[model samples]
Target: MKHLIALATALTLAAASVLFSAANAEANERYGKQKVVYHINYDGGQDDKKYRGARRNIQNHSNAVGAENMDIKVVLHGNGLGLLSQAKTNEALRGQVLELKGQNVAMHVCNNTLKGRKISYENDLFDVFAEDIVPSGVAELSHLQLQGYTYIKP
Candidate 1:
């Protein structure tokens, strides 16, 4: 009985693995290699639910396209900077940012917003670097679109 149960579990695991691989292959075939930019320009709300939803959307997009086959950028400016600011003290938001980063999704902060708001990227935002700063968020979006990146506002 024990052997039978163990065999059933192993077979189920193998079947799940095969199904997952097939799904990934199908997604790759349908989407191919993609360049995508997600724009975040609104305040995520008092509880940051909107930001959380945006993160979820990005994760879904990455999962569907396969991170290896996608170049993803997130452009934040205006009230969108709230995403990073909230993440500083919000563990869940921080984890989401780190997970997206792990998937090679670049988070680009607008230099104009930072300067206008007097916010320091090093001290105010979460895990931002000099390379992640763009002169203007709108310009970055336009540049990315010109470069063949599909724009998504979430």
Candidate 2:
């Protein structure tokens, strides 16, 4: 009976491993070619660790799907503007953003928030351009969803 239980456990583990491998392969092959939008709202990430996890999530997504296979964007609004708020003084954070950009990830900031905060992108954010400003971050996210981009709020 003990041997039977051990064998059962081993088989279950083996089956799980096989299933995981197949799923990972499909992730790398099938839906790797996908467009994804990551949404950020200030309220969710109350601390740096949570925000950093979100950033790491994006990098992991790229790693899983292959950066070239993904057209990714990070959309920030409301208090989420903190995504770039400390960029000037935070070299590590700035470097992470740039690395993702190097992978062709676009970072979108809400123009509405910028206006409300009295920020000029040219002078405020670490590495932002006029093209990166979405008139409304939520609306942009909705539009991207409409256009078949998978939305992830990390």
Candidate 3:
């Protein structure tokens, strides 16, 4: 009886693994290779929950499409810069940003916003560099869309 139970458990585990793989394969086929840009323009400092939700949405989208098959860009402008600023102090938000960065999600900041707000990318924001700054966030979004990237605002 013990041997039979063990065999059954092993078989069940194997079947479950196969099912999971099949589901992932189906998702890969459905999504294929995608270029997606997520837009953010709200102040996370005022409403951290919304910004956190946006991060979650990005992660969920990546998971659904498979990170390897995704080209994800996060365009931040205006108050959206608060997302990274909050991350500097909020451990949870910082971890999420790092995880997304690890998954190859590019975070682009608006040069105009930086100048207008006088926020230093080198010190004020988390993990941002000069290369990450776009001349204008709205223009960048439009350019990305013209280049065949699907726009998503979450």
Q: Model 2 residue 97 lDDT?
A: 82
Q: List, residue by residue over 1-154, the lDDT tens digit for candidate 3.
A: 9999999999999999999899989999998999999999987755499888999999999888899999999999998999999888889889999999999999999999999999999999999998999999999999999999999998
Per-residue alpha-carbon lDDT of candidate 2 for residues 38-127, written as tens digits (9 for 90 to 100):
998864344566668888999998878877789998899987777787666678778888888999999999999999989888887788
lDDT of 2 at 131: 90
* Pairwise lDDT winner, candidates 1 and 2: 1
Q: What TM-score, computed on C-alpha atoms, does each candidate reach?
A: 0.98, 0.78, 0.92
**Each prediction's whole-model lDDT (CA):** 0.96, 0.85, 0.94
TM value for model 1: 0.98
Error of 1 at 12 (Å): 0.7
Candidate 1: residue pairs that collide = none
Better of 1 and 3 by lDDT: 1
Model 3, residue 1: displacement in angstroms? 7.5
- The RMSD of every model to the true structure, in order and in angstroms, is 0.7, 7.2, 1.8
Shift in Å, residue 19, candidate 3 = 0.9
Any idea what lDDT model 3 has? 0.94
Best by lDDT: 1
Question: Candidate 3's error at 103, in angstroms?
Answer: 0.6
Q: How many backbone clashes does every candidate have?
A: 0, 1, 0
